[model samples]
Every structure is written in C-alpha cells, then in structure tokens.
Target: MDKKLKRKVLTASLVGSSIEWFDFFLYGTVAGLVLDELYFPSSDPIVALMLAYLSFSLTFFIRPLGGIIFSHIGDRIGRKKTLVITLSLMGGGTVLIGLLPTYAQIGVAAPILLIILRLIQGLGLGGEWGGSLLLAVEYAPKGKKGLFGSIPQMGVPIGLVLGTFTLTMMSLLPHEAFMTWGWRIPFILSALLVVFGLWIRAGINETRNLKKRKNPGRLPNYRLLIH
Candidate 1:
C-alpha cells in the first residue's frame, strides 16, 4: 500500500472509532447521571438507578446483533456503506435520547421509548467496534498489524474518559438545571463528532484484500467464534 493511503486509512479508522465510542460511552454516563429522572422517575432513587444501569448494560446485548448484521453486510456489500449506516444509527440514537420527553411530561411511555432508542444505539456500536478494527488492520503493512489495531482500540478508553469528565462537569451544576439541560449538551456534541468522523471516513478506500478473497463462504464459521 502507498504511504499516503496508509495515512488516510489510519486517520479514518481513528476518527470513526472515536465518534462511535463517544456516543456509546456517553450513554452509559447518562444512565447514571440522568436516566433515572428522565426516564424512570416513578421508582425509588436507588431502584431507578439500578434500572437505569440495567438499561445501559442492555446495549451490550444488542450490540452483537448489530455486529453480525453489519459484518455480513461488510463482507458482502462493503465496509463503507456498513460504516455509514452504523454511524448514522449511533448518531441518531444519541441525539434522539437528548430530545426524548421526560417521564414527567410523557408518563409511562418515556422509559419505553428510551429502551427502544438504546437498542438502536447498541446495534450501531456493535458494528462500530468490529468494523473499525477490521478497517484499521486489514490493509496494514506486515509486522505493524498490532499497532494499527491498537489505534482503533484507543478510542474506547478515550471515550470512557470523555464521558466521565462530561458527566462530572454536568454534575457540578445546580441539580435541577443539570437534570433539565446539561446532559443534552453531551448528546448534541455527538453531531459535531459525527460530521468530523464522516469527513475522515468518506475518504477511506475499500480493502482490496477482501476483493481478492473469493471465499466469503467461510464467514459464517466466524459466527460460532463470535457467540
């Protein structure tokens, strides 16, 4: 691969992975800091928190479904379209949560809507992780494969730290205002990151390595390993 092309792929992988994980990591943060009142206000504070955490954790369950659907699409159709779909889903889900009606306004329907949105988010991130890993390492030069894979891997910790700080800052505000509006800023910020990610990812070239492989049939075998 040309050095210029390597640079482009690396940039795309890093940016896209970062944005994807940012949406997911921040959702976990939101669950703890905001979801209790926003979605499930009827429960006792502790119970609401446990429910929020449970809802937050459910994203992991749906992520695998996202991964399988996306990986197949990536293997059959291509990575670019799959990535675009994943990013859009993640961005939309995150932003939707910000706009969601609070339990006080919407009553029983609020948490239900929240759970549905979370599943969409899980699906998006499921695709994001594996696809970013493949996009980074697939075309990397020999012996540097681990390093290339590590670039996308870095996005997870970066996202976690960002989420922690964002929530902590919001937590510092007057409790009412923090609950009312401060949390939305993080979700809305995802839009800017999504645009930036798209700009980088739009330029990534499809891997010719996949093109050379006539045996897409072997892909299903990977599923057993995934489970």
Candidate 2:
C-alpha cells in the first residue's frame, strides 16, 4: 500500500477503536458513580450499586457472542463494512443511553433499557477490536506490520484515559446539574466521534486480503468454539 493509504487505514483503525472503547468504558465509569443512583435505584445503596455494576458486567458475557457473529460476517463480507456496522451499533446505543429517561421517570423500564444498550455495546466492541486490528495490519508495509498492528491496541488506554478525564471534568458540575444532564454530554458528544470515524473508514479501500479472496467461505461454528 502507498504511504498515504496506509496512513489513512491506521488512522481509521485507531480512531474507530478508541471511540468504541471510550463508549464502552464510559458506562463502567458511570455504573457505580451515577447509574446506580439514577437508573438502578434501590432503598439500599449497596443493592443499587450492585445492580448498576450488574448492568456493566452484562456486557462481558455478551461480548463473545458478538465476536463470533460479527467475525463470521467479517470473514464473509469485508472488514470495512463490518467495522461500520459495529461502530454504528456501539455509538448508536451510547447516544440513546444519553437520551434515556431515568428510573425516576420510567421506573423499571429504565434499567431494562440500560441493560439492553449495554448488550449492544458489548456486541459492537467484540467485533470492533478484531476488525480494527486487521485494518491496520493488513494494509501495513511488509516489514512494519507488527508496528501497525499495535496501533489499534493503543486505543484501549487512550479510550480509558479520555473517558476518565471527560467524566472527571463533568463531575465538577453541581450535583443536581451533573445528575440532571452533565453526565449525558460525553455520551451525546460521542456521536460526533462516531461520525468522524465512519467518514475515515469509508474513505479507505477494502483490505488486500479480503480483495484477494474471490470466494470467502463460511466461518465454521467449531472455529468459534476453539477461539
């Protein structure tokens, strides 16, 4: 690949990976601190926090299923399209979470919706990491594939730092305002990052590996089990 195209591929991989992780981690950061109070309220604070963390934990269980499903699609279709689908699922769920009514407004439905969105986030992320890594590595120059592959992995820490910093700053608002709307800012603003990532990924060509394969076969179910 040409230098310019390679640069675009790596940038898309890193940016998309970072945005997905940022959205995923944002929920965890808020689960104990904010979601417990607003969406999983209970008479006992401990129960409420546990419920919130439960919602957070639900994602991990669902992620493997997501990985299998999307990985099959990635093998059958192409990485670019799968990346777009995963990002949309992840980012759309996040933006909607920001807009959801609290338990105070919707009662049990609030937590239920939160859990569903968390599942969607899990699925998106499960597919995202593999696709992003492939995008970077497949397009990398021959001798530098390892270096390019590592670029997408960097998104994890980058996303964690950004999520923590943004939430910390938002936490500075008065308790009332922060609970009321401040917490939503980062989630809502994530839409912009998603849009930007989509644009970048859209401009890149399909990976040479996928292009070379004229007839990509189905990903066997046993392979999923092995992985």
The Cα error of candidate 2 at residue 171, in Å, is 1.4
lDDT value for candidate 2? 0.88
Give the TM-scores of the predictions, in the order they appear: 0.90, 0.94
lDDT (Cα atoms) of all candidates against the true structure:
0.82, 0.88
lDDT of 1 by residue, 182-216 (tens): 88988887788888888788887787666765767
Q: Candidate 2: which pairs clash? A: none
What's the CA RMSD of model 1 in angstroms? 3.0
> What is candidate 1's TM-score against the reference?
0.90
lDDT tens string, model 2, 142-201? 678789889999899999998999999999999999989999999999999999999999
